[model samples]
Target: MSLVSPEYIRYFYYGAIVIMIPFIISDLLKKKKEDKIDGTKHFKISVYNILIAIAMMVVLFFLINSNYPS
Candidate 1:
């Protein structure tokens, strides 16, 4: 058996998105109450988290698409 199979890649891709949902939701909820808060730290954190998730997705895509011996 070989590692990094296509099916595993798909699962990793979807898993990353699923894991990010809660963070996204929290970010949205925070935005709704932005008026009450004073700092931009949470916003920055959320953006960073989103960017990291995207990076992971991209990496997974490339890994999955790369040519490898079956």
Candidate 2:
């Protein structure tokens, strides 16, 4: 009954992750010239974001698989 298929949604989710990773890396690696700070803060935030994204993606994969006809 849904307008969009789960396969497309899954692909979109993956595409989003692909697009997001580069920006996350950029944030992690970019110099903080204004505050003269190092990258520890960015590293922690980037790691947290990556972990959360992986967990969510795993959950999404299971949810999508469960909805498919078996």
Candidate 3:
């Protein structure tokens, strides 16, 4: 038998969701700061960065959950 708190699961799930809005907002601000960006550049850069962030998060979650490089 196992018991996990609802609060624990909520934070784990919604935390990831909550993170994405700020990421997109920051990306928008970054592009807005650039005076000479072409139309697709902002979207492209944001997509790339978001993907990288996701990859890193996945890696980190696994690493922290399990022993690695030990």
Candidate 4:
């Protein structure tokens, strides 16, 4: 048996990706209001999170479809 269920992993990844939407929106708004403030850091972090979410989606797909031990 797997230590963690694939369903739970799937939900977690989906939740993580969804939860970042508001933060991204907030960052954009903050950047617009404060022109001098640097937003590249927030953008970079969002990109990193997106990449990780994508990777986790692939992993979750594999885990759900394959018989490999988790």
lDDT of 2 by residue, 1-70 (tens): 1256864887787888899979866765663332246424655665687799899999989988896776
Clashing pairs in 1: none
Cα deviation of 65 in candidate 4 (Å)?
Answer: 0.2
Alpha-carbon runs more than 4 Å astray in model 3: 1-40, 68-70
Q: lDDT, candidate 2, residue 7?
A: 48
55, model 4: CA deviation in Å? 0.4
Per-residue lDDT tens digits of candidate 3, residues 21-69?
8987886787866635554466567768879999999999998999556
Please give the lDDT score for candidate 1: 0.76
Q: What is the lDDT of residue 49 in candidate 3?
A: 85
lDDT, candidate 4, at 55: 100
Against the hidden reference, what TM-scores do the models get?
A: 0.49, 0.47, 0.46, 0.43
Best by TM-score: 1
What's the true lDDT of residue 39 in model 4?
37
Off by over 4 Å in 1: 1-36
Better of 2 and 3 by TM-score: 2
Q: Give the CA lDDT, 0 to 100, for residue 48 in model 1.
A: 78
Error of 1 at 46 (Å): 0.4
Put down candidate 1 lDDT per residue, 1-70, tens digits, no spaces.
Answer: 1275865887787888899989878867877478347745666666778799899999999999999965
**For every model in order, what is the number of clashing pairs?**
0, 0, 0, 0
lDDT of 4 by residue, 20-67 (tens): 989878986675555547534665555577689999999989889998
